[model samples]
Target: MQSAVYPSLAGRTVFITGGGSGIGASLTRAFARQKANVAFVDIARDASRRLVDEIRQDVGVEPLFLACDLRDVEALKASIDTARERLGNIAVLLNNAANDDRHRLEEVTPALWDERIAINLRPMFFAAQAVVPQMRELGGGSIINFGSICWRIGTPDLSIYATAKAAVHGLSRSLARELGVHGIRVNTLSPGCVMTERQLRLWVTPRKQEIILSNQYLKRLIQPEHIAQFALFLAADDSAVCTAQEITVDAGWA
Candidate 1:
């Protein structure tokens, strides 16, 4: 599908987390196509390098791919610093790193719970913290935090993921209020059942596919590009006044 070119995005610096695979990879490709200077961090070196090669070949631009573990706040900050040093000031931050690893309630130990929180929620706040000064210096910016519809739908086997996703909205709203004065917009971008490679392999069986199709008003699968398009609007000047809002790309599943 053809998409709009956000003139405002050209030359702007964008920092993304977990941008090696799945939906994060889609965001990296989409933003790079718009002529944005994209810098993304992920621990998946192979996937990240492949994605960079793909984007470079297809879009004629290569995004800066930094290997990072989001659970390490200091490392996360260092990644942001690397982006600033190489790509210029960050104008858009897509807090898209998250793990929706399903776990039963009984299986959640304290260490496991902390690990879940670290992957699904903590990085978003700290990443936002790291970029605020850069955004402020640039006059204004956008922070699009990823949320899951699992929480709203109360999907089973994702207790910790859903809980962390639920917390994302509160974090976003709070950040919006605090950063609005600095012209920084923070909002949650929630997506429904997307058929990413990981999801298809681990979760989407025939019955699961049928259930997803039947529940959402639209009968088609939610693609990463669909989320990327909505995210483009959020990150661009088009949604300049939109903040503290929960935007869903669920195909009406919610």
Candidate 2:
């Protein structure tokens, strides 16, 4: 789908995590098309570099790609600082990094549970912490935290992940009140059954697809671009008054 351009996004610094592949990559391209200064961090160095090259050719502007593990709070903060120094003040932050690897409830060791929550939920807070100063300096900013419908759907085999995603709502609402006076907005962008390459390869079996199709009102798979389009609205001046909301793009499945 062709993406719409936003005058408010042009020249604005936008930071995205896990922006090298899957849905995050779609966001990288969408923001670039809007002429935003897009900077993304990911641990996949090769994929991240390829995405950087692709957008450079496709958009005529190279997005700053920082290869850093989001689990490392210090490294995450450093990468965000670098993006600000290179791109500009980050007025729009997309906390898109997460791992939804399915695990049996019984298979969750203390270490495994900690790792999952760290990757899925911890970065959202620290990244927000690191960027609030930048947003304060810019006078206002938008933060979009990526949540999932797995929790709301009561999908099994993802207890750890579901727990973290549910917590994202709490994070958004709490920060919304605290940051509203600073003109900063926080929102949870919950996606339903998005058919990304990773999900298609790893999880979308025939039976699961059938169940998903039967449940969704649209009877079509939600694409990563759909999420990106919604994100553009939240980042732009159009959603200036919107905050602390769970904006779902799940084809009415949620």
Candidate 3:
């Protein structure tokens, strides 16, 4: 692992949700390189364990991995509490766990809409609610939520998902105002179409890929590392004064 580009996080602790694969896993690696005591949760047990093991070997620090579904608020809260017990104070939180249910507005049933909101939007607030006191005890922290470019572009078949992401942007800003007194900074990271495994398997056909790249000024897919880098910036002291803002990392697609 290379040395972290941002300031060292040798003594800080970070808790990231959905850290088994894709952008979340990339963030785990990046933070581990910075020497933060990282704790993450994922629904994929095998992938989460593998990532923790790999980080232990490469960075010589074992990140805590909790396998749980983010939609289960009780389970999610337990996971964070467990991680805190093991890793000390969680100084940074990456609320990155999300699911996109693609459906036209007319096709979106009540259950479907509620599920999307539960998985994508609810955890962000509940997780922050669970961790804010701990963060205050630690003298302040950073809370970074994952938003989506779909919200800005009005993508097809993504009405519910886009709405949920838009809620995240609003949530971050409101939380920033609410938490600022405790020195906790809140921000949102809105990623464009990153070439994650899920995108490769389900979302992006070759033709669709071409269209996406063509829309970008860079004419290339956004990598997970790119988002991870921005996450590190927001996590570290470099973004100390930056809060309540949505930073887009989409290769100029949005």
Candidate maximizing lDDT? 1
TM-score of each: 0.98, 0.98, 0.95
lDDT string, candidate 2, 1-254, tens digits: 56577899999999999999999999999999999999999999999899899998988999999999998999999999999999889999999999988889889999999999989999999999999999999999999999999888898799999999999999999999999999999999999998888999998888988889999999887889999999999999989999999998999873
Global lDDT of each candidate: 0.94, 0.94, 0.89
Model 3 error, position 159 (Å): 1.4
- Where model 3 places Cα greater than 4 Å from the true spot, the runs are 1-4
Best candidate (score: TM-score): 1
Question: Which window of 10 residues has the lowest lDDT sum in candidate 3?
Answer: 1-10
Superposed by TM-score, candidate 3 places the C-alpha of residue 13 at a distance from the truth, in angstroms, of 1.0
lDDT of 3 at 214: 87
Better of 1 and 3 by TM-score: 1
TM-score of 1: 0.98
The pairs that clash in candidate 1 are none
Better model by lDDT: candidate 2 vs candidate 3: 2
Model 3 lDDT tens row, 82-103: 9889989889999998887477
Could you arrange the candidates by TM-score from highest to lowest? 1, 2, 3
